[model samples]
Target: MPDSISVHFASPAEMLFTDPQGRKLGKDPVHNVEYNEISGGVYYQESIGNPFPESSSQNDESKNIWIPEPVSGQYDIQVIGTGSGDYALDILTYDQTGNSKDITQTGNILSDITQEFELNYSVVSAEQTKLQRIVNIDIKPGSDPNSINCKNRKEVISVA
Candidate 1:
């Protein structure tokens, strides 16, 4: 088998949570989160109404808690909301000189325990420039197309 390079972010360092008013909440503790990785993508077994924890590494001196490290190839990203409403997943990517890109996945939270989604990003650079990427997942105030129903004790997974 090919050597697999995979890391699990089960702690606060891997997740970010927030309220409906855009206020940031610290990461919350969760239970029974199942992670699975395959050749083409990764999958997570998500329950319902499970809120993720926010970033705890923020301070006055060093505001940015999440750092972006770009690895060439394809990446599969996924996030599911355990709440009743939709949420936002904040993502940021930057270069060595501080050039950055911020992307947000809004209203994409899965209200149902059985529903999930994934994102694919291809990074290819012929030049000698390095790339960086950061991602933050949070819940949105409104909008629920899936109608999964977020209550409590929920889970979501992602793999790349």
Candidate 2:
């Protein structure tokens, strides 16, 4: 006779609601919302809006928001938006070795509606890196592609 052992893992997503300065905004008592930390990503009760300045003139430089990459291995990143206007999201990933990858997704949302999209990234030797990398996410209005704006209810999920 052979004996077998089973192992189970609980991977709840971690919700993050903060500004660029790492201020805790989602945990406010007024909102009264809590998020669960999953294995690969987070399950936020609400979405995160873009925090970049809108470009006024052609000579103005584009604004970009930077966020540290969560995991080290390959993952499927997802983003969701809810609004009436159409917006574009630009994602840029940078590794410790100075390698970078870029991804862009468009969301044409209507009034009182929602839209979602996903991007996939694979790292060959993720184990080699001891620390997580950084990823810059830029959101802008579709009409003014070069300018930046805040996206309402932007949800991000990472599944390894």
Off by over 4 Å in 1: 1-31, 34-68, 108-110, 113-160
Listed in order, each prediction's TM-score against the native is: 0.33, 0.34
Among all candidates shown, the one with the greatest TM-score? 2
- lDDT by residue (tens digit), candidate 2, 1-160: 1111111111112112332222321122223454323322232232334355484422212223333443344232222222234444455555544455555544454433222222233333222322122234454434433543233334433322
Single out the weakest 10-residue window by summed lDDT for candidate 2. 1-10
Quality of model 2 by C-alpha lDDT: 0.32
